[model samples]
Target chain A: MVPISYYLILSGILFACGVIGFLIKRNIITIFMSIELMLNGVNLSFVAFAAQWHHLSGQVFVFFVMVVAAAEASVGLAIIIAVFRTRETLNIDQVNLLKL
Target chain B: MLHLVLFLVFGAICVAGAVNLLAQNHPISSALSLVVVMASLAVEYLLLGAEFVAAVQVIVYAGAVMVLFVFVIMLLNAGAEERTQGSRVALVLGIPGVLAGGLLVAWVLVQRTNTPEVPLGALPGFPKTIGALLFHQFLLPFEVTSILVLIAIMGAVVLASRPEPKMKVPEKES
Candidate 1:
């Protein structure tokens, strides 16, 4: 049987990658992806702990997380597409009008 | 041995996908790499014995949602972003970020862990177990999540429905 440590480590690695990518990536879609990656990372931990505790709460949380992720994806992509039409670019550096 | 090998393989695949996500010039390729990341996550799910959630992860994330990402990438027709020309700013910011991530990893390693050792498929089945818990103890959270999804749906509609840029040359009557 695989230890939960391994799963936790992998999740941690992936989550950190997501955070760094989310911070560093300039493209709007890439940032969207990084956010998804971060959410997925959290979901993994939720499952791991759910398994660890034999409690169903963690699974329940994951279900909610998935619903939220779906909603986030829809809204995020819509915004990106809208921006794309107006600016003809998805680069964060170029989308600076909104930035203070 | 098999588990270790599979772990290493998936780990390599995930790392490669992340690198490609950064290296690829084409938006489609980058999106495809993101798919790889999601798929590997499903595998991790399987390893954890959450077969149902893993399946959902793959179908929803890799299959359905990632398709949306790819479509938008192609539709947007984004090109390679302007090169930073070895901007020192990148290095200055990047080094600290990497260090911060490394510290997180180290912290994870040092932290002692406690787990309840739940057996795989211990719930008798997912629908039953999940149902009882939600209706029994977690009803409020279930309701809140639904609200979250609903709000997100509304937000998506509002964002997508933003006024389209008017064409400089209106369609000519032929």
Candidate 2:
């Protein structure tokens, strides 16, 4: 049986990668995907703790997170479409209509 | 032994996929890389005995969310973003900052090794157990989430629908 620390460390690495991606990626969709990557990393740690503590609540939380992620994805994509329709680009820098 | 090997393999896959996701210029490619990452994480969930989570991770994340991403990319006719000159400030500070944060978390996790080892042969996350808990204990939150999904659907429809021409003249006149 592998130690829980291994899972935690892996989660940390994935999450850091997500953060870096989020920072560097210019495309809004890719940025959103990085957010999902971070969420997945968090989910991994949650399941690890659930196993470590011999409880199921952590997994339940994961379930909720997944649900919310799905909802967010749908709405976010729609907004992205609307933005593209108006601005004609998915580049975050170009979509600066709101910039004062 | 086998568990450790599986973990290493899947963990490597996940990290590699994440890096590829960052490196890819095209959103579709990044989306595919994210699918790889999600699939690997689903395997990790299975390793932790959360079969239902593993299934959901594959179905909802790798499957549905990624498909939605691809669809949006296609609909938008998105091209690879033209790389601008690198931002010196982000390069100078951001990489080290992220790396330091990750290393610090890893170090802290390594220091706290007193967590009880997962019992061998124990099935802690059987679907039945999770289902029972979901319905019996977490029912309200679950129902609320369903409503949230419904609202999201409606919101998406409203946002993405073509704007009526009546609003165009007001904006143009301004």
Candidate 3:
């Protein structure tokens, strides 16, 4: 038997890594990937809680989250394509049009 | 014992893939690392007995989403972005902040709580069961998400399409 806390800890570590990547990475695509990573961590947490409490709704929610993630990935990638076309760069710092 | 071993191994792989995603300089490599992370996460889900979710994680996330990311990277011809001064400063500050926050949460969850240990296959997440749940109890949300996916498809097509070239006007006769 594994302590549920271990699962939670792993999830937290993954989420922390994602946050670090999101903050430190300059590329837009990489940052988007980090967002996905963060979402994954949350998904794991949801499942762990589901297991703890024996609730199917938590698992059901994971499905909804996945649906949203898929939709987000499609739209986000399209937006990324548009941004790349105009700015000709993927660096977040350089893409700052409203920085001033 | 076996359950614990499997859980620890996959969890380590998941963490390694995540770290590699951050360490990789190129977007393609990072995208691949994310795929690895997602795959390992599916295994983790399976361990928790969410078999359907595990399969979906592998298919939808590792398969479709990562492929989409790779395709976009190739299409954009995105090169490795140079590390800027702002990124350096962010790395210096953000790493510690994230670490502290994560540690605090883990400490609270682990040390403070008296939560019981979970055995393997805590709950069966069969496809039939989940499907029923989705179509019955969560019916409205499921239908709404389908519409959302439809809109996303249209939006992606519109946004990614190149603008049509302008028509050439005839030159005026002298």
Candidate 4:
């Protein structure tokens, strides 16, 4: 059996990549994708720990996270569409009308 | 040995896909990379014995969520964003800092001595067990999530739909 640490390490790497992507990416969609990546990373760790502890709760929580992610994606994309309609761009810098 | 190999392979694939997602100029390419990441993560979940979450990952994330992303990209006719001059400090220091932080966390986790040995062949996340838990232990949250999804659907429709044009007032006779 693979050590749980390996899974945790991989999850950490994926999460860091997601954070870097979120920081560097200019497009809102890509930023959102990065967020999803981060969520996936966390889910992986949750499952790993679930396996470690012999509990089903982590997997169940991961399910809930997926559901929330789906809901967030729909609403977020709709908001993105609305922003594009009004602003004519998906660049985060350009969508700063709300910034004072 | 085989399990470790599979984990490494899928983990590598997922990381590469995430990097591609960051590097891609076009949203479509990024979305595709994200799909790859999701698919590979599903495989990882399977390897970890969470068959149900693995299936859910593929179906919801790769299938539905990615489709939504692609549809929005197409609908908006989104083009590649022009590269803006990012701050030099962020470019040079921020990335390494985040990576180091992650490494530190991983190291800390690995250093912990009391991690229990996971038994082989225990399928805690099998669909039957998950379903039972979801309905019996997590019924309220599950039902709430359905409602949340319904609200999201309504919100999307309302937000994306075009507002009707206001009728012009008739001019009074001079």
Candidate 5:
């Protein structure tokens, strides 16, 4: 048997990496990927907690989260494509202006 | 014993993939690393006995979402990252801060809560059980999310599609 804290710790580590990636990455798409990483980390936590409690709701919540993530990814990538169309660059630093 | 070893191994894979995602310069590389991370996460979910969630994680995340990310990267031909002053500062400051925060959280959780130990395949989250939960108790949210997905699809189409060309008006003769 593995301690529940172990899973939670791993999840925390993943979330921290995501935060670090979001902060340090220059590319907009890479930052977006970091958001996905954060979501994955949270999903892991949810499932871990569910297993610890022996409740199905947590797993159900993960399902809802996955649905939302799928929708968000589709819309977010489209927005990214649109931004690239206007800015002609993927670097977040260059996209400072609201109107170009 | 074997469960702990498997868990640790996959946990290491998850961390490695996430770190690789951070280390890689190009968006495509990061996207691939994210895929690796997600696949391993699916495995972890399976070990937790959330079988349905694991399958969805594999199919939706690894299959659909990553594909979308990779397709966009290819379409845009996104290049490697360039060093910027802001990024440099973030790299210097963010890593230690994040590491500290993670460690603190882990320590707190380990110390404060005597969370129970979970064996492999502890709580089998079968599809049938999940399906019943979705259709019965969570029915409203499920429908709402379907509508949300529809709206997202429409929004993506509108945002990504090219603008329509203006039509020429005929001049009136006196």
Candidate 6:
């Protein structure tokens, strides 16, 4: 039997992978892709819980989240493009002017 | 029997695509892998009997968001170059990554063995039920979240589309 916890654990693993990727990757696009991965991880958990509860609320929430993720992707990509134009480099290490 | 096969296939796809997303140096390749991962997740949602959720997964994530990723790649003129990889610190970090993944697998196995058999009763008219719940119970929060996302999107676009700085001529040496 495939328990819901199996899905939840998968979600957790995906989330951890996303976090590690976000922290370790130096590329701007890669970081945002990691963010997307993290979002997907959460969506999986939400759907799993929705199925477990026998309610559609969790799935509906996933719908909302997906919508938000879409908007975030568009705007985030636009900003990344803008940054690339200004800096001519996509390397996060090189963009450390934001850091003190 | 069929369900098991489908699950194995999609699960393998998700895992392999995720590994590719992270392991590949090219951002476009990673983005494509992410699409593969999202498609499989949508399949999982469909298998769970959440047709609406599955549709949202495909339409919003795989279709729209991934297109945005592709757009960024095109606009930036990104090429496959050597990714900054391998230092003492990165390798040190890899240890914890492996441990975390192993621990997660163990926990899942334990929990799966222990979970009781619970039959999920279906809610009639899934979409309508969800609609009622959102409108009646979570109406305020729902609208608020939408507004917040809208504001963030607008702000990002406005900031991103700002005028470029003009090139300045250097002053002549005395």
lDDT of 1 by residue, B46-103 (tens): 6656677778888888887889888887777777655443335656887587778778
On a 0 to 1 DockQ scale, where is model 6?
Answer: 0.44
**Candidate 5 CAPRI grade:** high
Candidate 6 collision pairs: none
Candidate 2 per-residue lDDT, tens place, B25-91, comes to 9999999999999999988888888899999899999889999999999888889977865466668
The best candidate by DockQ is 5
Task: Give the share of true interchain contacts found in each model.
Answer: 0.47, 0.79, 0.87, 0.72, 0.88, 0.39
Candidate 3 lDDT tens digits, B103-123: 789778867567778889887
Candidate 5 or 4, higher DockQ: 5
Model 3: residues >4 Å from true position, as ranges? A98-100, B87-100, B167-174
| Cα lDDT computed for each candidate against the true fold | 0.75, 0.87, 0.90, 0.86, 0.90, 0.76
Write the number of the candidate with greater lDDT, choosing between 4 and 6.
4
Q: After superposition, how far is residue A8 of candidate 3 from its true place, in Å?
A: 0.8
Q: What would you estimate as the lDDT of candidate 4?
A: 0.86
**Best model per TM-score:** 5
**Tens digits of lDDT, candidate 4, A11-39:** 88789889888888889988898899999
Docking band of candidate 4: medium
The CAPRI-style docking tier of model 1 reads medium
C-alpha TM-score for every candidate: 0.83, 0.91, 0.92, 0.90, 0.94, 0.83
Which residue pairs does candidate 3 place in steric collision? none
Q: Score the docking of each candidate (DockQ).
A: 0.51, 0.72, 0.79, 0.69, 0.80, 0.44
Cand. 6: chain B TM-score: 0.78
Off by over 4 Å in 4: B87-100, B113-121, B168-174
State the TM-score for model 3: 0.92
Which 10-residue span in candidate 4 chain B carries the lowest summed lDDT? B113-122
What interface RMSD do all candidates show, one decimal each?
A: 3.0, 1.7, 1.3, 1.8, 1.4, 3.2
**Off by more than 4 A, model 5:** B87-100
lDDT accuracy of residue A19 in candidate 2: 89
- What are the root-mean-square deviations of the candidates from the true structure over C-alphas? 4.8, 3.8, 2.6, 2.7, 1.9, 4.7
* Selected candidate, larger DockQ, 2 vs 4: 2
